[model samples]
Target: MANLAKIVYRPVGLVGGVVAGIVAGAIFKRVWKIVDREHDAPDALQAEYSWPKMLLAATLQGAIFAAVKAAIDRGGAKGFERATGEWPGS
Candidate 1:
């Protein structure tokens, strides 16, 4: 049962990961627009922005991405459990 659940969840997890990434990107873009009005968030290679601001942006983006991924993963797991009568995770 555990192996079967793992096999069934692989594709679900893949789709969930993709969807989470899209959602996180959209959210980060919107948030960056609001937080930094005239400029986009800094990438790792960019040095135009102050270190504090860049770090803050990176931290916020990471937090948002993690939260979105967790939510999507949990929802997918719950849905799988509902359909299969078995939890995907132990």
Candidate 2:
């Protein structure tokens, strides 16, 4: 049963992760626009952007991605358990 649940959860988890990424990207873009007054965040090798700007963008993106991923994963697991009466994670 546990193995079956794990199997069932693989696709759910993958979909959840992809959804999280999309959501986090949108959020980060909006935040970057508001905070930096720019349409796009600086890339690490953009050459025009300073080290501080690149690092700040990376840090903010990472934080938002992590938060959104965790929230989505937790919600998916809870929903799965509610539907199947089995927790997906150890």
Candidate 3:
């Protein structure tokens, strides 16, 4: 039963991860605009952006992605458990 639950959750988890990425990207963009008054964050390869600015953008983006992924994953797991009475991780 637990194995079956895990199997069923695999696809759901994949979809959830994709959704999380999309959401996190949007959020990071909005946040960067607010923080820097720019439409886009600095890319590491961009010659005009300073190293500190690029690093700050990278770190902020990473933190946002991690947070969004964790939130989505936990929500999915909780919903799955409620529906199947089995935790996918277990």
Per-prediction backbone clash count = 0, 0, 0
The residue-by-residue lDDT of candidate 1 on 1-90, one tens digit each, is 988999989999999999999999999999999999999998877878888888989998999999999999999999999999988886
lDDT of 3 by residue, 7-78 (tens): 999999999999999999999999999889954899888999989999999999999999999999999999
In model 3, the runs with Cα more than 4 Å from the true position are none
TM-score of each: 0.95, 0.95, 0.94
Q: Model 2, 1-89: lDDT tens per residue?
A: 88888999999999999999999999999999997995489998899998998999999999999999999999999999999999989
What are the clashing pairs of model 1? none
Per-residue error at 33 for model 3, in Å? 0.6
lDDT of each: 0.93, 0.95, 0.95
User: Ranking under lDDT, best-scoring first?
Assistant: 3, 2, 1
How much RMSD separates candidate 3 from the native structure? 1.0
Q: 2 or 3: which has the higher TM-score? A: 2
Task: List candidate 1 stretches off by more than 4 Å.
Answer: none
